[model samples]
Target: MTYRIEVDQEICVSSGRCVAEYPERFRFDDEEVAEGVPGAPPLPDDATLRLARACPSGALLVFDAQSGDEIDIFGT
Candidate 1:
């Protein structure tokens, strides 16, 4: 299943990791916080998880697209 990714600006550190790694999917807002690009193609589940885990500030969040349930990347 496809996954949805979001950036929590409140938690975002503006490291630019997501913007650099996935320019088509993410971009920095006026305040320099990372945000997901609207209408961007969805990422696969594995890649989505990897992206969430790679966020240094834990700003990236992953969700089950169909279920709208948040995925706990750090959970067992």
Candidate 2:
């Protein structure tokens, strides 16, 4: 199960909640602002959802690369 996380940079508000809560999967650079952690491996189910939930704009998106299905962490 290959997993990947992506964010809509245009919609991001730079609140930094996601980075603060899940630094393992997120980073806050002063110039670049907050972004998904680069070069990180696929995350366990729970950790993935935690990072999603921490996102304020729901800008974070998770998907199964093989299935091409959105990882419905919010069940929305």
Candidate 3:
């Protein structure tokens, strides 16, 4: 299974929550926007969801691995 994590660089506020919670999967780039590391091992679904929800600016998006649908962690 594969997962896709997308960060809206324009909307990101450099909160660092995603990197702090899942360093192996996310990191802050030179511009300070959270970036998903390519080829990183797939993280557990719950962990992925948590990281997406942790983004205070709601810039992180986690796609369902199988369905390719966006997971709305905040129920918004």
Candidate 4:
């Protein structure tokens, strides 16, 4: 299933971790916040989940597109 990957712009620190780890899936937007590339093919959930977990600022958010359920990588 496809996933809706995002970064909370307010919380983002432009760490580049997500972009560094998944350049094909994430990038620095015009505002420098990490943003998922629109229209990119779905990446494996595990891969995207790992990027979300690696976001030091906890700004990355991943949700199941079909289910609209947030995948809490932080386990909080």
Candidate 5:
């Protein structure tokens, strides 16, 4: 199943890691906070999880597209 990705701007530290790694999926807003690109193709589940986990500030959020449920990236 495809996953939807989002950025929690309040939690973002402006690290730019997401933007640098996935330019097509993420970009910096006027406030310099990271945000997901609209209309961008979603990444595979594994890759999406990896991207969220890679965020230094844990600002990247992942959701199950079909269910609209948020994934617990840090949960075991």
Candidate 6:
């Protein structure tokens, strides 16, 4: 199953927790736009949830690519 991650720019506070936690799967640009795509090694794992849970601004989002089923790691 393919999956993706989207960050809410409005709520993201430039916290690099996700990046630090899941460097392979999560990334942020200078604009602090977090993105998640399928990849290998160091890819996002349950640890991503930890980062998401820790993010005070609540920006992390996980979605199943085929089903569009979403998990608000940060809790909407």
Best by TM-score: 1
Reference-based TM-score of each model: 0.92, 0.71, 0.79, 0.80, 0.91, 0.58
What is the per-residue lDDT of model 6 for residues 41-65, given as tens digits with 9 covering 90 to 100? Answer: 4334565556657777777666776
Instruction: Name the TM-score of candidate 3.
Output: 0.79
Clashing pairs in 4: none
lDDT, candidate 4, 9-46, per-residue tens? 88999999888877877789898888877877767877
User: What C-alpha RMSD separates each model from the true structure?
Assistant: 1.2, 2.4, 2.4, 2.1, 1.2, 3.8
Worst 10 residues of 5 by lDDT: 67-76
- Residue-by-residue lDDT tens digits, candidate 2, 1-76: 6667777777778888777776787786666567777786667767777777777888788888788798887774
**What is candidate 5's lDDT per residue for 1-76, written digit by digit as tens?**
6788889899999999989998998999999999889899988788888989999998998888999999898772
lDDT of each: 0.89, 0.75, 0.78, 0.81, 0.88, 0.65
Model 3 CA lDDT for position 60: 81
In candidate 3, stretches whose alpha carbon ends up further than 4 angstroms from where it belongs are: 1-3
Give residue 76's lDDT in candidate 2 (0 to 100): 42
Against the correct fold, how does model 6 do in TM-score? 0.58
Can you tell me which runs of candidate 5 are displaced by over 4 Å? none
Measured on C-alpha atoms, candidate 4 has an lDDT of 0.81
